[model samples]
Target: MKRLLEFLGFLAVLQGVMGLVHEFADWNVGVVGRIGFLDGYEVYASVALLALGGALFAVAESRRSA
Candidate 1:
């Protein structure tokens, strides 16, 4: 669970960063436009994924400490 959380957290952070870069910087690293993926939706998805990842990480740490 801990490993899974860590991995998920990292991926979420990466997704957020990518979204930011694609939205503000106008630089799509992956098949964003080619695959018909929109940055407008990415921003919201990024927030949700990041929040979920953070919560998972916190829960994992708390469990480890307990």
Candidate 2:
């Protein structure tokens, strides 16, 4: 469970960074740019993803390694 959370957190952080980079630099990277409904809200979504990733990491840290 700890490992799962850590992996998910890492993926979230990666995607968040990629989304931000894609939006700012127009690099055509990450899933944030491809979603149709998130046309104008990519930045906000990316930020949310970053927050979620942080939260996931925190939760993972608080858990016991079983």
Candidate 3:
């Protein structure tokens, strides 16, 4: 539960950062740059992922350890 959420959150954050770096630096990194449908919306998606990761962290923090 908590661990799973934390892990997912970490992944999301990593991808989000990667996406943003890819966009700004044109480093050819992250999945956002590889997706054809997300051509013009990479930044938005990256930001969304970052938000989702934060929310997931918040939820994980509010949970009790089993």
lDDT: which candidate is best?
Answer: 2
lDDT of 1 by residue, 1-66 (tens): 677777777777677666656766878653332334653576676666668778877867776632
Strongest candidate by TM-score: 2
lDDT for each candidate structure: 0.66, 0.96, 0.94
Compute each candidate's TM-score over C-alphas.
0.69, 0.97, 0.95
Which is the better candidate, 2 or 3, if ranked by lDDT? 2
**Between candidates 1 and 3, the TM-score winner:** 3
**Clashes per prediction?**
0, 0, 0
Q: Rank the candidates by lDDT, best first.
A: 2, 3, 1
Task: Write the residue-wise lDDT of candidate 2 on 38-64 in tens digits.
Answer: 999999999999999999999999999
Please tell me which model should have the higher TM-score, number 1 or number 2: 2
| Steric clash count of candidate 2 | 0
